[model samples]
Target: MPKLTTPISDEEIRSLKAGDTVYLNGIIVTGRDAAHKFMIEHFIKKPVQPDEQELYDDLKELLDGGVIYHCGPVVKTHDDGSYSFVAAGPTTSIREEVYQADVIRHFNLKGVIGKGGMGGNTLKACAEQPAVYLHAIGGAASYIAQSVKEVLGVYKLEFGVPEAMWVIRVEDFPVVVTMDSHGTSLHDTIQAQSKEVLVGLIS
Candidate 1:
């Protein structure tokens, strides 16, 4: 497991190939369907205040070749008025198959994180955008949640926790690289290889 830490840049992420293991630290935003829709619908051009713009600006440079964790956490505030992650499970990567590639390009994002592989559209998106896809272990909610150290901000809280965008700081988040910038997919390779071996054995 590669120990991944803060101040990560786009160049660093692009340099990584498929099949590498990474332990992510620092901050990453969490976004899903509703949050995605809202961001796309925000046509107001209201000119965000300086403080508000800071997050996205920082996000751009760091994410220029970094990853997005597709997680919807279970959060409850503490008596001290601080929040924490309860269950930080990876959402199915397929749900955002529709918007992922486009989002990756729009944000200049380098990689995406989720569970259960994504299909060809996203894989193609990865190829075109030179983005990569990462897989988090499914059902390891509590273990994964431990990595979330803080929530800096959130968007669309009305959409509830799962559908909202959570801007969080994490430490030592575990993930496996499953897709490459060149469009080579670990899932596809596994499926095809599995079939060939199974057929050979049956014959």
Candidate 2:
């Protein structure tokens, strides 16, 4: 399997193709529906307020050349106030279809990890921004958590565990490239082929 790391370069992202298995290392960020909407509405689209400027800066620093995981991880809190992931499975990426493209561009993201693939907007954003969409095993939450070496930090805890933004460090995190930076999508091809097969059977 190919290896990927945070702060991934444009060259690295462009070299990936659909169907390539990869192991991701270094740092990744987590977000879901609420986080996505917050990023777009509060951070990216409008002017940052005095109170939010700090948050905006922090997000910029964290997200630069990083990977975003579409996950609502199960976390455990220790007595020392430290946190750990119990299960970290990829959520259905289509939920963020409305905001992903803008998020990628605004954050300079290189990769996205999720299941069920994304749509045309995200595909176009991938092509334009030279990013890749990686597919993690949906049912393999515990296995995925094994790769997360540390829980670096988190933001927006108000949204609760599922919607909070989690910053994590991972080692040899496994995923498959389903959408490549070159505008190639395994999901799209599979869907089209499936439709064709259905039509043939009906004829």
Candidate 3:
């Protein structure tokens, strides 16, 4: 229940433990499996397109050093070339294990936003890279989408919607950082501690 001062740094996130709370007011991005596949396909091959960097860069600057949410929002594009988000459920964090570390490293991201906590490899990657993992509240995508008032833009039509990169403008998106850069995972640690205590009393 400590008070956090201004400009919370990467080092500060490492010392945070389970049940610790933080208030953040920074930019965050949304990406999912489609986006990941696109990145990996281009990364593995020569390149998906000559302007791949441009595709990523167009919205990445706003995302770098900020959080990236693992979400593939269901949006409705209007006839006038505008769109509105209908549903925005969070995708599983485990699915991103393949490239989460790479994306974090490449973009120098500060934190990751998703539903469930990731595995050991991701935990270690977070520690070494000085980033954090966040858990979003479930069953609240409709409310969450309301927070997004405008659609800034989209990237890579070749990938298409769901896979095509999108840039949105949100009013106040809510989230919580559940893992930090010091190998502290709220999900892992809590499960272990709970199991030990329950077994001890029952035995």
TM-score (all chains, Cα) for each model: 0.81, 0.98, 0.78
Sort by lDDT, best first. Answer: 2, 1, 3
Q: Residue 75 of model 1: what lDDT?
A: 92
1-203: candidate 2 lDDT, tens digit per residue: 68988899999998999999999999889999999999999988899899989888988988899999999999999999999999999999999999999999999999999999999999999999989999999979999999998998899999999889999999999999999999999999999999999999999
> Which residue segments of model 2 deviate by more than 4 Å?
none
How do the residues 1-203 of candidate 1 rate in per-residue lDDT, one tens digit apiece?
Answer: 67655555545666777788998888777877775554444411244456557655655655665667778889988898777889998988887877777677767676788998788888887777777787899889999888888887776678897877777888888888798777778998999999999999999
Q: How many backbone clashes does candidate 1 have?
A: 1
In candidate 3, which residue pairs clash?
none
lDDT of each: 0.76, 0.94, 0.70
Best by lDDT: 2
**Which lDDT value does model 3 have at 8?**
38
Instruction: Write model 3 residue lDDT over 1-203, tens digit each, in one string.
Output: 44332123676666666455554343455778877766666653444466666665654575566666687788898999898888775778888888788777776677777788888777887888788787777768898788777776766645656655666665546666678787778888888999999999999
Name the runs in model 1 displaced over 4 angstroms: 41-66, 197-203
* Alpha-carbon runs more than 4 Å astray in model 3: 1-17, 20-26, 44-49, 157-160, 197-203
